[model samples]
Target: MAARSSHLSLALLLVMAVGCAAQDYDFFYLVLQWPGSYCDTRQSCCYPKSGKPAADFGIHGLWPNRDDGSYPQNCNPDAAFDPSKVSDLLSELRANWPTLACPTNDGLRFWGHEWEKHGTCAANAFNEHGYFQTALRLRDQLNVLDALTSGGVSPDGGYYTLGQIKDAIKRGTGFEPYVECNRDESGNTQLYQLYFCVDTAGDRFIDCPVLPRGRACSNRIEFPAF
Candidate 1:
């Protein structure tokens, strides 16, 4: 009887260790891919914006509105453009929860800018990596929300707090947390950060792209649920 009890204790210990190992693996993977997981850039100054002549905008960057300004000269066939990919972000929210009623407004609201609209919105508003990053954060957070509703573990590996979803963007996981955004040093819009969260009291939206500097719009994101 004594030996059986000892064996049972050892088995429980082994099971706990395995669980810990799995959690560590998931947490670290998120840390390493933190940046690439959630950000993208656009070609704003690369093409001259209207009113500003092509020469004034220069050739190094894109400026949104020039007829003959700098663009991907000799566009490659392999990298065709498409916008349907990101349009669903809005649609999904509408479909999943009908009463939310967040409008597909006239112009895009890119935070900080306070209601900037795209004259002609493109197919890929969320950018390349934004797809995976938003998906992962949303999925993980949804899991947490579900567990909370059902009364289970938070799935932060028991490390992050309930509010850490927003905090994690700047400080990351497995480290002493600290606030990192809220400035305009690198052309990153601080408002875009809101969209990246997995869950929020408000409607969810993905972080839009800021050309030249990726993740600059991290603060501008909306946490829409669909």
Candidate 2:
């Protein structure tokens, strides 16, 4: 009986060790892109064959990030992106995650890149379908445009303080989001993206340990008109 008990304890230890060694990210960065800002810099933005996306911020990507400002990508080579797996989500994806690359691009290519680079890394927590479904659900839950507009921030070429933007998002979502911006042709800082950190479960929001590299924004930023 003592030998059997020892074997069971060893087995449990092995299981725990394997769990700890798993390829898991620290958190998820739910990134949203401002179409207006992107088009202003690029001079032109292409839409998928479906149609132009709504003026609202679109999903840039759902990335897996680490605590040290670095992130994992293309984690599983074998888990290649399969478009058929997410066929049911194409409508929502086209509406929310449209490709804005220049010279026109397909949603499938954008999804493939996202899946190969980021989705594969998050495979332990979510399969391809769950990874995308969670993003769409979260986008519906967190309304960045409404949050800013309600807080007196509009896209009519108005300059806002970074503190104001963060405060507004916190008031709307009960959590502060990491704000990112880029400079316009006139050298004014404009809101480019917003990233909210999510736990590995891809369910709840969490405070980011460190922001993404080179995502610093000035104290006052502009929200360009679409």
What's model 1's TM-score? 0.20
Residue runs of model 1 more than 4 Å from their true location after superposition: 1-85, 93-107, 110-133, 152-226
How well does model 1 score by local distance difference test? 0.26
The segments of candidate 2 whose C-alpha lies over 4 angstroms from its true place after superposition are: 1-17, 21-23
lDDT of 1 by residue, 110-150 (tens): 21011111111111223322432343344334332333323
User: Candidate 1, residue 113: CA error in Å?
Assistant: 7.8
For candidate 1, the per-residue lDDT at 99 reads 20
Model 2 score (lDDT): 0.86
Q: What TM value does model 2 have? A: 0.89
Worst 10 residues of 2 by lDDT: 16-25
